[model samples]
Target chain A: MNSLFFYISEAVIGMKRSIVMMLISVITITISLFIFGVFLLISLNLNNIANSINSNLEIKVFLKETVTKTERSKFKQAILKLDHVKKVNYTSKNIAWKKFVKEYPHLNLDNLFENSPLPNSFTIGLDNNQYILNVVSNLKTFKSWVEKVSYGGIIAERMQKFSYYIKILGLILVIILTIATLFIVVNTIRLTIINRQNEINIMQLVGATNNFIKGPFIIEGILIGILGSLGAVIFLKIAYTFLIIKCNKILPYIPIVQNKLEINIILVSVILLGIILGILGALLSLSKALKRYSFNKVK
Target chain B: MIKLKNISKYYQSNSLILNNINLTINKGEFVYLVGPSGAGKSTILNLLLKIEEPTSGELFIDGVSLLRLKDSKIPYLRRNIGVIFQDFKLLPKRTVFENIAFALRFYNYSRSRIRRQVYQVLDLVGLTTKLDCYPTELSGGEQQRICIARAIVNNPQILLADEPTGSLDPETSWEIMTLLSKINMRDTTVIVATHNRGIVDDIRKRVISINKGAIARDEEQGSYNS
Candidate 1:
């Protein structure tokens, strides 16, 4: 126990000697993880927006204007009977005309025509928004002379492709940053080990074991890792908050909703990531340091 | 209490450092090892210190065979034997007090005890005022004295010093020799290895001479005749 205290004190002194190098390491790690954390936050928000769009998507089935009232009623009943159909609403020509005027109140549509020229349309809603593509394809087989069946699958497909690219880029960034962080940590700790090499040699001659010699260095690495991770977490929080506020203000056309639950989730994930990286960095450097130094052969 | 029977240590494929060495130093016995350069004077210290194993032989300390001991048990053996070197290998960054206190920490000494013992040893070596001085700030003689204080801080049963006065002048060397003699009188086996014929002739102690890695002379109250 007394030996452990001495070793810890020695580690602190060693770190103090290279305080500038230690700060550089911590800053590098924080920046790397911050980049990763910000990318994750953006991707998560994009995913949430895509989900909201999918839920509100509607499949529109236009009908032949020449159809009679009884045929339309039968067609509507058939759609409501379908297994996947959630709701069915038939828009008459008058109702469609009224909605068009409501959308363009200042356009003075009353001067254009005596009677409404808009055709009656059937707006379809599905039980599961994700299945709209398949649902629209099935609707095309209806016997009510379906003019056209259109769903938001095309836009959804494009968004999905974009999401794929974002994920790939995020992964690549993480790989590059992780390798760079490890390299930086390994080199810094290596310099530290070199500075104390003679002391280590003397300790070995005095019958210190491999564990005894390595304990201080490993502890130093761990401390650095922890501090770096904390810095990253702080940076992530600031970035996430800034993004949420800025995006909400700039992109008013697309409603941006910040889910408090998701923010909590990402915050927790970043904290855990910081801890894992800290421990990993320590363990990685220690393994390399031990290989270059053999306790029994110090003399 | 060290026993070496037919111990022979060789280097590479042909060169030998120690050949068929048989010797025993009883408990509380002080002995001086005198030899020219490359005569295995340090090799004998290295073997007893268990830094290297013998090529063929049996070595026992307190009836425990060092050659057969596991690596984990080596530290326990070393705790009983304090070692000092010719270079005064005190850590340059540490103070005189810290250097000595470091040895006691390994033995799990309490903080108060470590402080008291370190100061005691510093005073014994006449370095109480220089306790906070770094090795680089001290003279060659003072650094060597600090090394001696560090070696004896743990109160080991055996003290193995290799060419301790090799870098010191006549007066300082004699002072070191007197200190070792005083330490030996305290029932700690002190083995000093050196090539200083002047000190050998003056001390007239039990001297073991080595030539070409083999013992050539062993005499009580011996002087430098080679």
Candidate 2:
């Protein structure tokens, strides 16, 4: 156990002395993981925003001109009780007329019409945008006194399709970045291993097991990975803050700003990414160091 | 104890590197291997070290058949055999003290024990003053002495030196030979492979000569007659 600790300590010292290589490795890994983190953040928020918009796309159900106030109340209560329906809000003709007049008082509607021409309607919201299909199917059970049922069907479909594309694109980006990160880390560790060829031979001769010889290099690789991941996390936090400020300035009304919870998740994920990547780099380096070379026999 | 029986190592399906060789060296016996280049002098050392398997023979070092030994056991086998090379093979980046201390690390010796053994061996090689110096800063003879210090630090049962004085001058060569002789006197079986006729002739140790991948002569106290 003491020997293992000594070897690990020695390996760390060796990595420290070779600061240039260590820095380079850290920078490469950080950049790759930062890219991945940014994509993750954007993808998650995009999903949330998409779901919000879908739920708000409500159906407007128009009532018949001769329907009684009691009949309208019954219709409203029945729609609200439906499985998918979240809420039923009644918009009376007088309320609609008043809202129209408030927005456009100079349109001369008073002289053109004797009374409010619009029919009393129900604005029906579903629990989720996907529940629109179920709500539409249930509305078919309504009586002929219902004039029309209108919802943003085409718009909802388009937005859903767009969100799907974005998710797929994000997944592809993640895979590409992960692969690139592994490749860069592995190659960097391989160079370090090659540099220690003589040390490896001496260790082999000393009756050190393969694990004993590889443990240090593996630890070194992991350290490099951790440092790199840490760098990435720092970079990502700064980038996220800067991007949030920039987006707020550019499109303040778009609500693109992330909450504290979202930012915290990003931070945690980036740190975990660093640790995983570091372990991967160490594994790659260990396998290379584990390879035996014969000093007694000519290659 | 080391034993070789009908050991023949062939290459390219045409010629043997070591042909039907049979020999044994008891514990604490000093032996010298001398031959021309590519004459299987190094091959014999490699075989005994278990660095290469003999194609058609059985080898037993301390009653352990190296031929049937697992790959993982090779390092344990090597621990008992101290190897010295002409190139010194010292880690150039490390100080002389570190190089010697490293030999003990493989065996996981205690910290105080490593320090004592390293210092003792450095004193033995007369390199105690240059303990902090790296191999590149040391002279050729000094570097080779450090290699010797490293080999003996573990106090292995067998010391195998392959042309240890090949690059040194005649005076330095004699110094290294004398050091080997001294080490052998301490009861570790020593084997030196060399083409340096002057040093081999002067030593007058037991000699095994090889030519064209075969043992040409084996003498109890041979000279470089070939």
Candidate 3:
């Protein structure tokens, strides 16, 4: 307990001694972590939007009016059994006509077609867009019952592919940004260690153990990391709130993850990430310093 | 309490700094390592501290062979030995008391214990009133005194002073030597390396004179010359 107090006091004194350099280090860490947090937030919202769109996609299978009722029921059962198929809703010709007319107010069914020309159809909702082609091919195989099988094939496929690419790009970007942040933080701590070279030498010469000398430095690094992370998290929360409000006003159709609980989770994660980065940076620099200016090497 | 057997140190393959040296100093002995510059006085002290490993030799402090000791055990060995340098290597930013306390803190002594020990050392070095003064704020002699206080604060069995008064006047040199003698009287083995002929002649303690890298003379109640 006494040693713990000494280590903490030493770390505090060290921080005070190099206040300007430490401030620079903390600010650099804050900026780096904040930028990384922004990237994470963008990627998360993009994934959420893509998921919503995929869930809303549906395939329409038109049936021949001459098909028997038993065959129509079998077709519905087959679709429901297929992989990725979520649910199937059957619509009779008369209901389809009513829905069509409701969708297009100017259209008069009696004028457009002599007698309800709309055919019975099955609206197929799927769990995923990955099996869209397979489901379409399977529906087309039932030639006797299926008159036409149609889905937004080109658009849905493009959207799915785009979402996949976005995820990959987001991962790559986060990795690069994290590495860059680590580099900056490590260098900053290195400079702090170099500034305390003399003090370190004195401590070593006076019979201070390696752990005794390194404990305060590690604490200093952690403290700087926590301070930097706190600043970044606070700034990110405010910036994210502002961005969400602006985006809501400008593009309401864009589905964003706006749950208060989720936002809090992200903030907490950012703080944790900031701390981890700080510790990693400090460890890297301290090990380097130890290698270069070991206690035994002091003249 | 300190023993060296056939100690040899060489930076280059061909040139030796300390070659085939052997020496010993028992407990409570005050010995002066008298030599000219470059005669390997500092090298011998460095060897004892294990700062620079000897090319060949065995060093034993209280029967523990330093050469065979693990790297992790070096700090523990150093705790039993106190070293004072020619430049008075005190932390410039720390007060005199902190400088003394710095050594004790490394050993994880309680705060009260450290404070008590630091005060005791401060009083021993006759700087009890200068506890709060920084090294930069103190005179040359006073700074050396703080260095002494820091060195002996741990109550090390062996105190090695390498040119402790190399930068002080004759009177200050005598004062530092007197403090060292007082420490030696308390059964601490004190080894001072110096060419300060005045103090060497005045104190007339045991002297080991070195010329080149070998011992030229070893005498009891020895003076500056002969």
Each prediction's TM-score against the native?
Answer: 0.83, 0.81, 0.83
Off by over 4 Å in 1: A1-8, A50-75, A81-83, A89-131, A138-165, A252-299
Model 3, chain B only, scores a TM-score of: 0.97
Report the lDDT tens digits of candidate 1 across residue range A1-299.
Answer: 77767767877887888888888878887888788777777677667667666766898888886688888888888888877899998887788888888766545686686777877789988887767767787888975567778776676667767777898899899889988887787676766877887776666666676677777877777677778877888877776678667765676435444677877776667666655665566567667665555433422
Question: Residue B146 of candidate 3: its Cα lDDT?
Answer: 89
Model 1 agreement with the true structure over B99-200: per-residue lDDT tens digits: 887776666768899999999888888889998888999988899889889888878899999988999999999999888888888899999999889998
| Selected candidate, larger lDDT, 1 vs 3 | 3
What fraction of the true Cα-Cα contacts (under 8 Å, chains A to B) does candidate 2 also have? 0.63
Interface DockQ of candidate 3? 0.49
TM-score of chain A of each: 0.70, 0.67, 0.66
Query: What TM-score should be assigned to candidate 2?
Result: 0.81
* Candidates 1 onward: DockQ, in order: 0.46, 0.47, 0.49
User: RMSDs, each prediction?
Assistant: 5.1, 6.1, 5.9
The runs of at least 3 residues in candidate 3 whose Cα sits more than 4 Å from the true structure, single-residue gaps closed, are A55-57, A60-122, A125-131, A134-164, A260-262, A295-299
Clash pairs (backbone) in predicted model 1: none
Better DockQ candidate (1, 2): 2
On lDDT, the candidate that comes out on top is 3
